[model samples]
Target: MAGNDVEAEKPAHSLFDNLQGLAFGVIMVSFGISLLKAQGLITGQAAGVAFLISYSGGIEFGLVFFVVNLPFYVLAALRIGWGFTLRSLACVASISVLTSLAPRLFSYAHVEPFSGAVVAGLCVGIGSIGLFRHGASGGGVGILAYYIQQRTGFRAGWLQLLLDAVIFTAAAFVLPGWGVLVSMVGALALNLLVAVNHRGDWYIAR
Candidate 1:
């Protein structure tokens, strides 16, 4: 009877968690897109390059997002287990599709740059935690960071910082120089929140 109760509860709990992840993922993607529209900031990643291309060429950001992530899905499968990779892929799909559609429905104009940066970072960070709890992520630099952590001992956060540095450095030419700094600050906030909160031994989630 106890085992039966546990089994029944498990699926319910999983459904709840997935719904929560989906909700947060929507907010995170929306926040990111809003930041881009408001700040003209390019995030440091393949996504950043995609944003730059989209901004300059008038391409849809979501299509650019999906294209940029295609190659990394293979790397994710090779490094992480298939299940983790698939879940991450799902997250990427949700984010990309919603990112594309949400902007069409909503206006993100008139947000102050500094306020938007901080709020956007917090939204992305909290949303990332929600996705990570469900075995998923936003899946850009995070994918590369995961692969690096698998092959080398460097922490995923550190690798992410390095990658962001290079990517944002290149971004100087693509955006106003100061926008690069704001984007870097946003990345720092997001990455810091992830590094601090996501410890394997801290939470006994089953």
Candidate 2:
């Protein structure tokens, strides 16, 4: 009991730790985004909105994603704190830049839709865990979800899942019917992973 308490009392992550963790999270998420782009698939949350706009408008995903997240910074700062808001901003910017560079860096020959969905889901989910553990996020809906979870005892993933349903529904009009279904699978996988693993009681870090 004493040892457990001591363990719980350990300090939050250092600057170096946060930098590496956030970088890892951003890279993983960017790779996942690239995979989704390769297959012409979409996921949920603000990223989904960016994908939809990018696909239809022929605008860049990074630009759209960054713009979509602008409003959320206010919410994040007011509710979550400046530290969290700043870290989230950095993570979001890094993802935007990396995802833009991803196409120039490498191209995929082919990726099966189902396989891509699962793999992309896993990558994003794991990466999100890293961000959450390090007191940051991919921004946009993530900031709202995390704030709600912290204030209301609601699980962030479940909240995100609910929001994802709305996003996927909108996706139906933008994408083919089958594509929307497959995207939902990816969203489900990602949200379920977060739901199970993102328990606040299990982690003491800020």
TM per candidate comes to 0.81, 0.94
Which ten-residue region of model 2 has the weakest summed lDDT?
Answer: 197-206
Off by over 4 Å in 2: 1-8
> Each model's C-alpha lDDT?
0.70, 0.89
With a 3 Å backbone cut-off (N, CA, C), the pairs that clash in candidate 1 are none
lDDT of 1 at 78: 75
lDDT tens per residue, model 2, 7-32: 77877888898888898999988988
Q: Which candidate is the best by lDDT?
A: 2
lDDT of 2: 0.89
lDDT of 1 by residue, 82-157 (tens): 8768777777777778777766677765877766776777677677666656666576677777556546745666
